[model samples]
Target: MFEKSYDVAVCGGGIAGAAAAIASARQGKKTVFIEKTVMSGGLATTGLIYIYLPLCDGYGTQVLFGIAEELLLASLKYGPGNIPNWRIGKNAEEAKRYRIIFSPASFTLAIDELLVNAGVDIWYDTLICGAQVENGRLTAVEVENKSGRGRINAKCFVDATGDADVAHFAGLDCPTAQNALAFWVLEHAKGAKWRLEGSIESVSMHADGGSIDKKRGMSGIDGAEVTKFILDGRAKYLARLKKEYASGNQSRTTLFPLTLPSMAQFRTTRHIPALYKLRDGEDWKHFDDSIGMTADWRKSGFVWEIPYRSMVPVGLKNLVAAGRCTAAEEDAWEVTRVIPTAALTGEAAGTAAALCADKGISPDELPVTVLQDALRKAGNKIHLEDVGLAPKK
Candidate 1:
């Protein structure tokens, strides 16, 4: 098998992995970004989840910054969407929240450009199949692509796969969650109700149920389960199209799917049990080791300080989990699973990995203060007070 080396290896090319690779490369570390698909942005772009989510606390303040905000702005460079009143000042109205809906194709192009500009080595259509661990530290990842199997050795690794694939392969205890069946498709129709701004396409959503429950949900970790889940979602989409055409309101020429999600739309999957497992009801809580802040996109006035410890999985050295694979529990997972928080944690993980590599130490050994300082230097606001806010009473 061919072997390569880098300062940092990032698994997954989604938003989180993209942010991680970019952050690591910008820190002057040699970084390699691995992805199973051709495009970046993961669910945000490929899964038809176009909403960038809010970067503000939803009250009147911007809580998230750094690469999170950078990716949000980049998503618009090739798309037709804007955050009204964003530059002027904060808007308290929920409708005016700091968010934008971008075209998936356009955002993919923008992020690809950003990755190249950041000097990140990108391996598209590459899947991570295994991991190499020695003395409690991850040393390399085995990958499969058209070139056959290969191994990538790095000083540090970021598991941004959104499923904790790297951590799981490294023998870490990663908990699994059930995901409700759902499908989103981009379509074009005459008199489309959900048409995107400045585009001829509209997005439609189909779901098996409103809430996720064990009875009606499936795990995304299993190969067969993932296959079934994706098939079920596509079946739902087919039924919807059939029903729409049966209504006789539109013809095939007027209403047809323009694009379907290139990947499964599982909301939650596997996550490592990190040193600090962030749980629900801790919004606005302070953490001395906070890497950055993320707002609850579902509601206003709720924000959480993301701890660096939450990204460090137990029993793993030189490896950190980011994005949806971070250690978040229950309601906390819901908050951190979105696009904004993914980018937030991804940037933090990448920076931490680079720092660890530079020190020739594991992530658990790197001082939190060092990581925090680096983040702040990179334009990230790590604490509530940094954004002129305080812990919730």
Candidate 2:
């Protein structure tokens, strides 16, 4: 096996992984980003989940900032989406929410550009096979690519695999949740009047054979389960198209799938049971160690302070979890798994990893205030009051 070294090694290349790699590299660390596939934006781009949710509380204030906002704007650079002038103090109704619908391909290109600009060493089509842990600290990750097996030794690591692959590899206790079936595809339909500022339109098949149903769900962590989930989703998509054609209302030429999701659209998989798990009904709550704030994308006037403790996995010294694998449960998981919160937590984890590497310390050994200060200096609003909002009385 070949040997390599870096200051920070970010596992996974999705939205969270991209943000982590960029944040670490920007902090002057030698960072390497590893991805199992060629694409960058994970589910957001490859899974056809292209909506960049919201950055605002949905009432009238913008809550998320830094890389979350940067990626949202970047998503539109090569795609079709618009950001309302929310910075000018227009209300949500008048200015519209801070969100956009982007082309997945375009967002992939933009993410690659951002990664390159940040001086991140990127390894595409590389799969993480194992990890090396010593004295309760992660040391290096074993990976395989076309170059064969190799070991990437880093001072600190960020687990952004969405499925908690790194933490699981390190023998950490990771809890999982079932995901409802959802298959979103981009199609070209003749006279598709409700197109989303693009020539093509997105169509979805949900769990109950409808669109975006969440009742019946299944586990996504097992290998066979993943295979069946994908196959079952495709079968449902095929059934939908067959019905459309049989009705004599649409034909292959009139309406057909332009692109299918290259990855499974499972919403939640596995996550670390961190030091602090953000649970349901914590909306508008305050955390003294909050690294940043994220709004509830599903509804307006609801926000949550993301605790730095939530990213720190127990019994691990140099590893922090981000994105869907963070310590958020139930309704909180639904909020943190989206694009905005993924980037938010990704940036925080990456910054913390860099700080740990620089100081030759572990993630838990580092002070939360130091991490919070670094994040705030990078234009992130760490708490509710930082954005001129307060917890509900």
- Model 1 — TM-score against the truth? 0.95
lDDT agreement with native, every candidate = 0.87, 0.87
List where candidate 2 sits over 4 angstroms from the true fold.
85-95, 191-194, 198-215
Give the per-residue lDDT of model 2 (tens digit) for 1-393.
899999999999999999999999999999999999999999988887867888987666889999999999999898676776655433354226788778889999999999999999999999998999998889999999999999999999999999999999999978988777888877766555434565334442112232545556777888898888888888888887788899998898777787888888888888887999999998889899998999887677788999888899988889998898998888988888899999999999999999999999988888999999999999999888888887772
Query: Tens digits of per-residue lDDT for model 1 on 150-206?
Result: 999999999999999999999988888887777777777667654456663444322
Tell how far residue 340 is off in model 2, in angstroms: 0.1
Query: In model 1, which range of ten residues has the least summed lDDT?
Result: 204-213
Residue 179's lDDT within candidate 2 is 75
How well does candidate 1 match the true structure, expressed as C-alpha RMSD? 2.3
TM-score of 2: 0.94
